[model samples]
Target chain A: MSTRRLIPGSAELRAEFPILAREVHKRPLIYLDNAATSQKPAPVIAKLVECYERWNANVHRGVHKLSEEATEHYEGARAKIARHIGASDPAEIVFTRGATEAINLVAQTFGRTRLAAGDEVLITALEHHSNIVPWQMICRERGAVLKVVPITDAGDLVAGAFESLLTPRTRLAAFTWVSNALGTVNPVVEMTALARARGITTLVDACQAVPHFALNVRSLDADFLVFSGHKVYGPNGSGVLHGKRALLESLPPWQGGGDMIASVTFEESTWNHVPHKFEAGTPDYPATVALATALDWLSALGWDAVAAHEHTLLAAAEEALGAIQGVRLIGTPAHRSGVLSFTLDGVHPHDLGTVLDRMGVAIRAGHHCAQPVMDRLGVPATARASFSVFNTLEDVAALAAAVRETKRLFGA
Target chain B: MNDLDDLYQEMILGHARQPRNFGALAPCDRSAKGHNPLCGDRVTVYLRMDGERVREIQFDGAGCAICTASASLMTDGVKGLARPAIERVFQDVHELATGKSDGSKDLGKLAVFSGVSAFPMRVKCATLPWHTLLAALDSTSAPVTTE
Candidate 1:
């Protein structure tokens, strides 16, 4: 089962990312840090340059030619995001800095407006710090409690615990579709449906999921779905926050600035509609346009091919690394995606990461901004090797060899 | 293996595996916690000073190999050094790790960190314990942070 299989277009995909061709520490770079941020493809990079070179102007308010082109591309990107996520209306997709800001927008606006004293915001232990901290901030401000659903030792969410945690006071529920640190793919569709049945608002952090698989927000029935562009082969500081039209109309605006106001007199200002109300100021138009190109690029590749390719990498890494003496893989969730974290018995993750780096293999070695998960797992940190479209079997071999070297260094 | 060996010398690994003076000191005169928030490495330096000399120096914490090894070597190196000498050692280690100066003969076992100069990122890991020792000596309660 661990035998390597060729992924069609895999070579072409690898060639598209220029960074992969370079060497680190005099060794060819074997990038296993995709969960942190994916290396951008050639088309995505070109799209960014095209947006700046061809249509560089402030969006929404200019009558000039460049402005019109910029506004056209900006709104066009929003439409592309809406279509990609299966949202019927483009007006529902709000642009933000990234997934963090998108989650913060919902927490501050929807959360602050709807939640009251004694209310609870339910989250999962698998959530990234972005998903966890925003709810904590909003809950604290609204005099609401923040509750967490527990996960098993295998990093799977405890299904029974989730139902018990959901109460009449659970005003909202937010969770990651795919855990960044642990590779656990949460039961997002079922969890969203459960929350919907109880009339609790739901938000899904698809930062990790969007890169590995195709997503349709409508089928998931989440009130809000967010993912960063950088994670999905797009430019940095660009993301989509897909909210239900009715829910967005109900919530108050997050930021007050030029583009978000319909009319501003000296005293009172009328807020703009849904997306514009949330997206204040002149946005990063180049990044927005480049994000659309990234979606198109992935759509061209198709999910079947992408998913199959990533699975092979994950499976091979699991088999190769598990065979190493004294190496303990962190999570074996029944369903997982994108990441593989592990600990070597005698070598600290930092040492492993440093050694791996010397061998031209890059991996994350820390809590991965999810301290709660670390606290639960009883480890300070784990060395993580995350897969992406560009990763191949050679990369996995390099990773396995590096782990063996690390073990040898520690005399295991 | 050229520069990497320098950073993780056999001596450094030995010190990390069996850190010297690794435990809390009871009724310690001066103690300060050190934190490297980026990697969640924490160390608490305890000093029992005898007038101008460090009578006892010990550390208790969890950290990466570089940090643990540095702390172990630091405690073992500075146990009998006076304040002025400890200050000089700190400067020498700093210079050695940053490649600003050659390994002074005085650095001794601590010279094992001279390879750390090649890996700029790990310099903090080797110096955090030393700074925490300074904080303890200064009698400050604020945790020393190596950002």
Candidate 2:
């Protein structure tokens, strides 16, 4: 196959990810499972080391120099993350374990306090289990009903469904900007606007969108937005929850611990501030700083370039894989990003995943924690190959080849 | 890293393609369902025990190649065996699939599952049928899950 230059400085950009050079099963590794989690770039890895080597101390409490420096870098990371998502104030950004925790934090604090019996929480069918289960728990506890917006057969959200679900009883509307299972990019801006106009709060799960889109919380007008660090080429245990300052201040603290307290007595303890009160315990300072480094590295590459490169790869994969007989692409949304889910006619996804592993092509093959989407598509699971900025046309070709080999092996 | 052929032997693939006893057993005396939530594999084992002697056994489910084949082979291997003999064969097959015991001990036609030991992640897929069968024999009401 001839090498195609899709992204400028493509080779250099690939070189920045050291793991891309390694071999699996004596063949070159084609890591296509970006939706599961991304491979960390060299600078992001180095930032973790730099944080541990230079400023190894707990943040925010101690008067020592190390603590002060650690606190500065930690807070600096919050500010960078805020800016990356176009938030005006750093105080609005609260660090959580990952997108799962971020959503749960909002559900426990906001959903628990604001929602009353007979109130409704609206969600789409495209949500991952993390987004679904937390609201279910909170809704069950508060006697609130959980309303689901269905999707069309093409994996797009059913047209006009969001507006219909926004009744007076609907207190919150949480949805994903991009579907991880099918790569369906929802109309988050319009949906958020619709909910906002009806005086209902909105939460956007941008875990799959942050790497591919230049998000602006101010323009999107979501009351809360969240994304995971590991999914965006950063360390695990780091994530951001950006809520409007007034909205966050209105909700009470979910968890009580050492750092979130302003003052303590035998009878009473005052909360510290907006973000800190939500943070609760000691934060993962190094991982937070490294997450900021990842954002900086991605920003230097430019979001438009990254989106273009990934789109090229996804389109190439769709064309190549779709041409093969018995290879059924799961979602045909008008707009998609990064993820491509498919299933072969005779072979199950688990068997296909095992065969692809032998060929050194890593793809996610399962329900993808979105069983409802699988049920909607009328399949038990699918083999999903998600793309990233470092992925190339060559990788798409490799995926197609591996899939063909799988079909041959299975006599399908 | 064993070759794919080691796992997907012709016999296993054949059974997976067209599973034997692959439907609900009518007027079954005992039955149990097995589920592997991680991969969404589900199997139901039905048994018609005739006074603890030779009897009929069958299974039906939706599973992967390994799981479907394993269940198919299990029904064929365990049918007509007494309670004691079925228990012994179950131990042997479990040991063979987990690599605790080599195929040197005769597992009859069940020895085809020996290849499953190499793929540690797939062991559950290979053994879901056996677990369900055991649950059916014990008449356990709760469904067996390989979590």
Candidate 3:
């Protein structure tokens, strides 16, 4: 794997991320927490500043020039996001606070309206809390049952589980495209096809997937998909919910406010169009424009190059970190990406995290918001070091050394 | 790594490895569970009260080194004290862990955790046990959470 050939501009690209040069605790920072949130590049940050400095105004209401410019940039962002994911129409993209809000919108509107008593909402054990909890709330409220498709010990979905789970009573199937905790890439396209065959509406939580590869929602055939901006090296409070045009049009408005209405009376109100009906209040226009900048920057890198770079780092991390004594790798999926989760002998993940932090090697040490996954793995928690395009072989070496130091400190 | 050394002294690590009064107290009078949802660290403090004084105290659950060591030191620190005296010690320990005051005056063996003040995010780990103990004393049914 010649990373230089895979990404010829890798050095220049790495320089674009300013925070990579920062030092934490008097040592140069080795930021391996990309799964939680990715560091923003210079273009994305500059776009945010430009939005605030040049055209900072509410969209769709005012006829002033600033509002018009803001609206163009905001709507332009929607089109860019839709095209990035290969959605058929820009109207399918709904701006959200983040993936959590995006999932909740579908649950509150579509799930609330469509589900009936005795119906089942199928999710997988690999889902983040954002993907699981909304469905749980909707299921409990509608007297619907929540079904979980279990994963194998290696963290992959059990073979034939999706086909078997999709029965007549299963109203919708929601699952993650990648496991944030274990970095296990689910067979989402196949799963979605199975659900569609059984007339089940499918939603893919692509928060972890979008950063690592290109996704085509049309080819995927999932009725809905979601991702957060911050996880994609974009600004926080920016997210996207991509739905099939007809499916989004069929759903009722999730929230009621000024921009979402067509005609309002004290007695009754008529709603706006598909995407606008879902976006109730003033959207985060600046963040949305910056998110578009992030997508453009990422797309310019070419998904193949990004994937190749990250894959190399992830493989190096696995080998280096695994070589240390008593360091147990948690997930060994056939198609893993970007994340390496592990636990050390006689040392808790939190303790490992603290020692690593002292050495400026930042990693996540928790259940990773997948408590059921933690329960299935039969561990309290695991330390996770997720990668990005900016990470290098040296970062992996730093992580390995930090783990060794942590072991020595604990006398493991 | 001065701060790291301060945070994980040999005493703290030893207590974490072999907790003094671990496991549930059978025939216990009062008990409460403490949870730090941030890291999924959990502990249940159990007390066998002899009228106004604590006759025996034990705790059982899984947590990080700081949490387990803090619980171990806490049980050992408050075993013989009466309810009022235990509450006073809790206040002092809380102040010491938060870096409001040094424990040189009265914290005794519990002063091993004075190093925790340097790591603000870990204050909850060192104090979750004390909170559960307070909850047990108050006979609260809800599990104490260090958010």
Please list the Cα RMSD from the true structure of every candidate, rounded to 1 decimal place: 3.1, 2.8, 2.2
Candidate 3 lDDT over B37-129, as tens digits, reads: 899899999999988678899999999999999999999989878878888887888888889984357678888788888999899999899
Sorting all predicted structures by TM-score, with the top scorer first, yields 3, 2, 1
- lDDT score for residue A323 of model 1: 97
Tell me, by lDDT, which candidate is best.
3
Question: What docking grade does candidate 3 earn?
Answer: high
lDDT of 1 by residue, B1-147 (tens): 778888888998898999999999988989999988767788999989898679998999989989999999999888878778888898998999999884446667887888999998788888999999999999799999997
Task: Specify the highest-TM-score model's number.
Answer: 3
RMSD of 1: 3.1
Model 1 / residue B52 / CA error / Å: 6.0
The Cα error of candidate 2 at residue A357, in Å, is 0.3
Off by over 4 Å in 2: A1-9, B52-54, B82-87
Clashing pairs in 1: none
- lDDT per residue, candidate 3, A81-198, as tens digits? 8889998699999999999999999999989999999999999999999999999999999999999999999999999987888889999999999999999999999999999988
Q: Kindly state the number of residue pairs that clash in model 3.
A: 0
Rank all candidate structures by their DockQ, best first, as comma-separated numbers: 3, 1, 2
Off by over 4 Å in 3: A1-9, B102-104
Q: Candidate 1 overall Cα lDDT vs. reference?
A: 0.89
User: Which candidate gets the maximum DockQ versus the true structure?
Assistant: 3
